[model samples]
Target: MGFSRRVGPPIVSAAVATLVLTNFAMVLLAERASHDGHLFASIWPIALTSTVAVVLVMSFLFRSIVEMGAELERREAEAQHQALHDQLTGLANRALLEDRLEQALCRYRRSGEQLALLILDLDRFKQVNDTLGHTAGDDMVRIVAERLRALLRDSDTVARIGGDEFAIIQARPRGEADVRSLCERIIETVGEPYRLGEREARVGVSIGAVFAGPDIATATDLLRKADITMYRAKAAGRHCFRIFTEAMDADVQRRDQIETILRAELAAGGGPELHFQPVIGGDGKIASVEGLMRWDQAVVGPIAPAEIVPVAEECGLIEQLGYNLVRQACALARRFPDLSISINLSPVQFRTMDFPAVLRRLVEGEGVPCSQLELEVTEQLFIDHGPLCEPALQALREAGFRICLDDFGTGYSSLSCLRRFPVDKVKLDHSFVDLAARDQSIALIRAAVTLGHAMNMEVIAEGISCEAEEQIALEAGCDGLQGHLYARAMPADQLQAWLAEAGKARISDAA
Candidate 1:
């Protein structure tokens, strides 16, 4: 195309000039020959032949130029389309979507009619990508795009703004109800299974929507608010939608503050500090100490693990946080060689492909025996991850780290998980101990303890806070009891002091 553009014009100009000159020379020759009177008819025939030949050559040259121009036009149109559309899903790209949104916003301001902008992020998309490969993930995304196109009005715009992210512009939304209805349809349609070659994939969408109004002054504002709302939807447990509110802005700002503080804390060498609580064995001795993460920042007062973990996970600091805990546990393990140091594991940490190997390296690097570490995980980890957790758990067990199922019996499939997973202990959820007065609760506790014993696993009752609760747990045949009843969680140095005191008491009794 470049060559033709540069060379074709000059060549065509030269050809035209030559054609004119040749015709003029033939006309002059014919006129001069006609003056001779004897050769007039012959000269006319020769002149007509010369003129026809020149016209034929110029016509072919002009046709070639026209065809080249058409080809260039077609290619330019294609390039423009490609630039404005997603190559994979063929939906509008972010730039085009924003341009359209800005146009819609202008019309909205003029007409005072509401338009809606929605941002959608696919949940579990990464797991699909990691497990099934990008090809299948792409197929799933395209299927989602098709469903979105089908579910919306022809006037609506659907755009693929990022990997596993989409945006929708509802140009003529009647009201908030209309936006909600659209979101519901999108969630239902996109959640349906996608068949990608031999494999089937499933994903859910979290949507955030913002309506055009006084608050939304520009397209960028609308998109930003919609994205924040989408995150709120995800936090509420995906496959749902949330509308923007002033209150949501406050929450987002607070989260941003937390993220900034956390990063600074981590950069300074650590974020959350570890506190240890004793787990008293049935034999009347301290069996192990569970490492509890504590963050008492001056700015936030005291942030619970429940609050910190979600933020860490969202900000891509979960793996780093988990490793921090492991290193702390390892250091503590070295300090108290005889006692196992248990730490809770997040589902995100467990599902990482390199989790087992990385964990082995971290533990070995610290020179702590794997047996001195017990990893606590909620049953929900296995329930959510299923077969993916098996090899990781097996690898950890082979490396001699004990696996404890935290918050046991809360999930419907706890018993099933016990049968399948390589769990060495079950920590009775606090709810059972809290309701120890109920006959059903006592029976369930006893049954859990009995089943655990039958399976040759230890059953530990957590959250015991009173003498009565401890007695109940003991009578229920728990192998261990932990909670405020024994001792509140304390710093590692304080726990060392407590352990030393307990050792002296034991020595006095032996004497």
Candidate 2:
């Protein structure tokens, strides 16, 4: 607009002057060629009048053109702004954020002032999206965005990098303390409940922060490291913040290596080997054995069960890996036909509708009886999937496979879980077993055991590593007990030999 106001009038004036000069020059030439000065005088006045009229019309047209140009310039500016910002949140988009981060890096290179980059992922927002409509989800996002804007300085850049993911750039942060304060505030602010129309929703945030220093000189490195740390915060259990560390990078790399090896192993029709730990019955006989998956990679040494599940799930191999373990457990059931073979199930396995059907087919195909196979699921499965898990569980039960609630007392609403689900058994968590001597612990376990019996469900005490723990569990009326006191997890052949030896001891005692 300013350009048009300053330059438009000058261009219009130059054109009008050029037109008048040309008319005057033409009239003069005609007068000189014909030697008619009076004719020149008459024609000059008419030509000047026509030139004035033309200038009036042309000036109006030029003014309109200039105005159109200005409007177009304004529209272009708006388009650029829209391109660089998130349409929904109206915050800076990833492109603009990256650009600003690059500029900040340049400034840091010159001044050596510290800056912080934070990446946040909203936890449990998916539940809102799944249970409510997307409209509710959008409202939640807007609320979070507005809260973030109110919390931070104007100079800080907030970007919606992905759905349910946000990034922040704190240029000229006071120090690490400043960064920590900002992250803490963000988590607290965002974790507050949101109201969307008639319904209320809640979400938590996991934040990963990195400071610009000697190691983090580029935008990409900063973002990547912060993202890695953000996942660490999530793994540490959401609603917390984790600062970037070199060790985190190493762990991520190792996990990547494990994922690659697992992919290769699965593709080749192989996976983690199965080991069985015996669960002894009250009569001092082997009643059941829970199958535990073990991984001993030559390169990465031994991967813990906790580590294996996350890597497999991240790589989309959890179901396959889980099914493989089930098949192996079923095969072992054939060797010890009378012993119950229990296998752990990840919550991811219950996602599909065909999970129960798939398991039935696998076990039946291996010529194993469904009654001898027990499916162990954590209470988290119920909490996460809720009633949605009922159909599959019922189908498994109707098909003669038992459902045992693993880590029973460690979750919410234990009593309600027993009443709601068709759980055939309960495994008291090790934490309770360790504290069995306490009067409160004994009462809780005894109550749990009595409740299970009333529901016609078997109660098992797990993680009993000593005689004192075993006696406490027995006094609590637990029907079955399993832990290091009985036997550690062993390979299939070793377990078979152990079973054979135990049978002979029983026969000798009977004689």
Candidate 3:
């Protein structure tokens, strides 16, 4: 249309000019013929013939120009359409969706109709990308987009906002029920299996929804609120939808606060402290001490590891935190030459390609022998991270550091991990110790101990909080015991004093 508007006038003017020039020439010829005494009938006929021929030629030229303009307009329209739509899925792009959302809001304002915006993010989408490559990931996105479009009304707008994310503008929804039912349908459709070439891919969507009301003023606000709601759904669990709520906003604010505080504390070099929990050998001596992080905030007081660790991981502070703890633990271990130190490894740390080198540098700088340092990793590392974790673990083992599989028997592939990795010790999770009174639990623990021994690995029963639990662990033939029944995690000075007393006790018993 734009092209035609710009070029149509010039073509029409050229045709008109040619016709006018032909008319003027005919008039001149008639005058000359009259002056030369030619017959008026013959002159008139010649003039008429010339005028008709010029008019026909002009008409043909005009029609050709009009057709050219029309073709240009058609191509321009196709280009515009392509620009506003996703090339992969043919869904509306963000720009088009935003424009449509604004239009929808305007209609709602005039007619008092309700409009709902839903933002969806696919769950575990990265797994597909990591495992199957981006081509498969694109295929999955295309499949999901088709499913979403099929589930929506013609009046509704579904868009691919970005990778693994989509948005929908639902026009004139009846109420919450209507919005929720649409969301449910979208989730169900997306949850269905998709065949990407030879592989079967599956993923679920988390949806956040917001409706036009007193709170929503523009497309941006609607989209932001819906996004917040969608994250809440993800937190609740994927394959679900959540409506925007005031409480969710508060939770987001609190998390932001926590992350800010953590960053500030770490920057100031006054973050979580490293404490040691004694891991006693079966012969009743402190064989090694496990380093535990303790965060005592001035505002929140003492935070649990469960709460603090996730915050660190989410905010990308886990690697620094883990490294700092390891360095400090190594420095502290130097104070007691015979005491080996164990520190927990976060999955974030293992994900780093240079984590082994980083650990070596920290230990070497602290003047602690690598053999005296034990790195503990949960079974989830193998299950969640898979092959990416192998090189880091292997590198650390090659550096002369012992690797302990923490919370063993808690994961599905624990035995596989044992077979694949060079693990020095296996720490039985507390659940088994708690349920040791049951015959089956004891049998499981005993089997784990026997397997550990057969593999030439030490087996430690953790969370031995009672004498009965200790006795059960001993009976199960665990090489070590660790829990509150022995001693709580203590500060450096306290742990040092306790280690001295235990050493003396061992020497006296030998004497």
Best by lDDT: 2
Pairs with backbone N, CA or C atoms under 3 Å apart (clashes), candidate 1 = none
Put the candidates in TM-score order, highest first. Answer: 2, 3, 1
lDDT of each: 0.86, 0.87, 0.85
Ordered by lDDT, highest first, the candidates read 2, 1, 3
Question: What is the C-alpha lDDT profile of model 3 across 176-208, one tens digit per residue?
Answer: 999999989988889998898898988999999
Can you write out model 2's per-residue Cα lDDT over 51-106, one digit (the tens) per residue?
A: 99989987897889789779878998899999999999999999999999999988
Clashing pairs in 2: none
Identify the runs in model 2 with alpha carbons over 4 angstroms from their true place: 1-25, 36-42, 121-144, 162-164, 187-205, 235-237, 435-446, 504-511
Record all residue pairs in model 3 with backbone atoms less than 3 Å apart, i.e. clashing: 208-230
lDDT of 2: 0.87
The reply for model 3, stretches above 4 Å from the true place, is 1-61, 105-112, 122-143, 174-176, 193-206, 210-218, 228-247, 264-268, 298-304, 311-316, 435-441, 497-511
Alpha-carbon deviation at 198 in model 3, angstroms: 6.6
